[model samples]
Target: MGMTIALDAMGGDRAPGIVVDGAALALRERPDLRFLLIGDRARIEPLLVRHRRLSAAVELVHTSEAVAADAKPSLALRQGRQSSMRLAIDAVKDGRAAAAVSAGNTGALMAMSKFVLKTLPGIDRPAIAAVVPARRRPVVMLDLGANVDCTAQHLFEFAVMGEAYARAALGVDRPSVGLLNVGTEDIKGHEAVRDAAALIRDSGLGIDYRGFVEGTDIPEGTVDVVVTDGFTGNVALKVAEGAVRLMASSLGDAFRASLRAKLGYLFVSPALRALRQRFDPRLYNGAMFVGLAGIVVKSHGGTDAIGFSHAIGSAVRLVEEGTNDRITAEMRKIASPGPQLVAASS
Candidate 1:
């Protein structure tokens, strides 16, 4: 009866095993939450048995088919409606689960979600959102591969969605937003961003549109949200990850360079590890496909139990906060303006 997360049991690279393990942890840790594991019952039940404590908190819904990791999403969906991903999505639509979580093929998950839940009344397409840790409050970033290319309008829409999310998660009233661009100048970007910036600046959408912010400023915490298209957003996400890894590796090498440095490392190793974990991109792996009709979180495909738990926890928070109602309200104000849409409907 409380918020339930319907997990795609046969998802990600690890499938039923790793996902089940995370579900076990979440159930043991959170008393109010429940789980519906959607996949082949034979495979999932045995896995759940191994974690006997989770037996009471989890239910299995059998789904025979599976959409493989690298298969074409649309094609997979058409041929594999009985797969775990589709079944899990259906649970949300059928009012059985408050949310759904999957680490399956990204395109397949999105495609099935778009079909099963459809878009919200005012949203044209949904975007993926990630919360990035900053020097201060975490920054909400989107569209993390929701749409490969996006219009300025789409970016603007993402801004609204990001603000709504930040407000709920960070308790940020009137969160300041920055458009991701090569430069901060108003005239510095392609026509899309320039036009989007003008619209966000003037629209008075209850979110603070703080002009443009570049990639370098993402971790600065000067801004609460960064808005961009999926192409740039995905690249930024990977770059931040790679940078962190390289920095950590370099630090290890430097620490072992000399006896004095080794002594220093012994003194500072704890602090350094803490800092590394704090900035680790892997720590912020789960992201919501924002602007959807229901709460759907997509996790990193290659994730361990720790990373997977983040996605489950995010789904719980999003569900409790009435994400759907807030999303619907935001989209209504900016419902794709066009006489053609109105005329077509008429």
Candidate 2:
């Protein structure tokens, strides 16, 4: 009776091994959580046998085909009808599972999910949303790589969805929403962002609308939800990742540059490790495909079992919080007439 998550056992780079290990890790944390593992039984069964706790918690549905990492989205859609990824999503659509999680090809997963689950009412396109570390805590960012060119209306809808997700997943009671732009000033952004800001401000969706935010604002925690087109969002996401990697590399170089520095590192090793854990992407592995009729979390394909476990935990949290219902209710409110807005202060 607790939340059930459907997993595509053959979706990730490591496939059944990491999938089974991740499920075991998740099961150890949440005993009541159940899983419907869809993949080749030959590969998965052996792995599951090693974890007795996970063996009892899963219901396997074997599938012979799997979407290839390099396959085009269209190709995947045509040939992946019986694939593990598709079947896992099917479980969510069929009401047999509360959510679906995959570490498969992004395009294939998005295509199959849209085709099977369809979009929610009033949502023209589904956006990929993820939580990123911020100054205070993690901020919810949407349109990570879903639609490259989003209209003003699409950005507005993203704000509504992101705000709801922040409340549900991040436990932020009243999250401030910011439109990602070149500058925070009202006159600085292009027509799309400027227009979206006006819509968010006047429409009164109840979320705290902080007009505009620059790239620096992201890590500064200027707002709780940062909304932008997929192109910009994706680029920003990658740049942030590269920056983290560069810092780590530079730190390593500095430590090895001098004998004194190497000795200094010994004293600071514990603090450095703590800092690394704070910024580890594994802590935020799941990226939710928002605007869908059902919940679907996309994990990083190359992540290890620990990262995959975090992804499963994210799916469970979304289900337990009724995130989809909150999105639907907010969408309905935004669709209705009047200068209506909810009651959170800006």
Candidate 3:
């Protein structure tokens, strides 16, 4: 049977319209794909009438309510039982859909998904893992604002999950894993990071556990997966985003400075276009909430139809690759007795 994805149709900035458009775009690429679009039917039906193929593939689930963009996670969880975001997540939990895709409030989606689907058997907490552009290829980084405070074991688990993700998503046979730290030295970073490194190295998990990696290593692609706590990982992600924007803005300013610069831009335009395509953030719009029992992909709230389609594609890839099954099996390996985990000094 073809995959059915649950979409929080009213969750994004351009609701119903862009969501419908994105679904159409995804369907064009994968004709077998079907959608369970959860939102206000009145607003969504008009948009669907425009796309004949998508109209045929989509099943609308009506809900008047939607979680507000600025709503707190706690408040949304308490009050948003009937909201589109919550209902879409519920679809995954109830097996109405293979996975749920939402361009909603990140915290609310995470909170609802966890409450409904719960975590996998051995997972303590779910982490947000996403692919980021790197020198050689995209790198998988985790805990992207999911758990601000993570223990050594949490970070260790993140590494395991990340490794599996890299293999499934990036098609790498043996992806190298690294713990993010201020320096690559053993004594660097706080207690949790140090302990996590020790656990990965000594756990007999068969991971390519590269000891430690600095911030530069992320863009340099020093490791296939970089694991860190939510606070640091989120900060690093934001900084990289800001830097990309700054570069784009600065280049535009330079290109428009004078007629000579304009001429120069034309000469280099092809190379620049290639560069832009390689580093385009829209291509990597989805962040998978790994360790969840059912698949839940978080799309960027401000992304366009194409970006949202990419996010939907991400959910499809995970479902096809059986990512969650791989994670569950790997977790079982660590739980069994092979090599004792190295305890950190207090």
Candidate 4:
């Protein structure tokens, strides 16, 4: 069957418009794909009606709920039952969709996903996974925010699942893995890091535990997989993304001020375009919440049509590769007890 992406049209900061436009773009580009944009028909029908080219390509699902970006997670999930996030995920859980994508509040989506689809067997919690461009293959970082407070054993489990992600997504043989830490040295991290390192060190799971890595290493594209608790990992991911935008914007403002600089920019404009594409958050939007029973992707909150297209494209690839099914089997394989933690957080 052709892959279908269920998008939460009312989820992002720019609702139906950006979501709908992106779906239209994807539908136009990929002839083998279809999208079910979940939102309010009353609000979206006119938007669709105006675009004859897009009107025929997209289908709308009337979602009566709204989960504002800053709303409390608990309240958002409880009150926003008709939310596009919930409805879109429902499409996946009920087999109406192969995968679902959203740009809603992270915590709220995580909470609702647990409630609607639940986790795979032997998987304690779902970890958000992001694909970061690297020198070789894209590095996949997990636990972006599914579990803020995690145990040492949980971190080890993350490594296992992360490896599965790299294998399924990156096609690496034994995806080199490492734990994000305060320092790259062996004695750098908290108890959880030390414990996870030991567990993976002697693991018979055929994974390459490549020691420790730092925040700077993320942009350097040094590791195939970087594992950390959501609290720490998420901060690093945001900081890195913000840094890219800050530097790019700063450089843009600098080069546009002078005639000499403007002339110089023309010479390097092509290079700059290449670099911008590499750092574009749109290119990074298709992050999966690993350990879940089905595929769920989270896109940037501020994404427009361009970014949304990329996210939907990613959902198609994930579904085609059967990534979630492979991840679930991996979690079941290492369900046994591993090394013990010495009462510490990573």
Q: Which lDDT values do the candidates have, in the order given?
A: 0.83, 0.91, 0.93, 0.81
Backbone clashes counted, model 3: 0
Q: Which regions in candidate 1 have their CA more than 4 angstroms from the true location? A: 334-346
lDDT of 1 by residue, 249-316 (tens): 89889988999999988889888879878876556767888888877899888887777877887788
Q: Which ten contiguous residues of candidate 2 have the minimum total lDDT?
A: 337-346
Could you tell me the C-alpha RMSD of candidate 1 in Å?
A: 3.6
How badly does each model clash, as a count of residue pairs? Answer: 0, 2, 0, 0
lDDT of 1 at 58: 80
Model 2: per-residue lDDT, tens digit, 146-208?
999889999998998898888876988899999999987778878998998988887756779
Quote model 3's TM-score: 0.96
- In candidate 4, stretches whose alpha carbon ends up further than 4 angstroms from where it belongs are 50-58, 135-137, 171-173, 336-346
Candidate 4, after superposition: displacement of residue 134 in Å? 3.6
Question: After best superposition, candidate 1 residue 225: deviation in angstroms?
Answer: 1.0
TM-score of each: 0.92, 0.96, 0.96, 0.89
lDDT tens digits, residues 1-346, model 4?
Answer: 3577888988788887888888778877886677787888888887786666666655678877778899898998789878888889989999988889998788888888888888878777778888887666578897887788988778887887888777766767778888998897888878888888988876667778888988877777688899999999888888877877798889999999999999999999999898877766776676778778888888888888898888888777777777677766666656654545323432
Clashing pairs for predicted structure model 2, backbone only: 204-341, 206-342
RMSD (CA, Å), candidate 2 to true, equals: 3.4
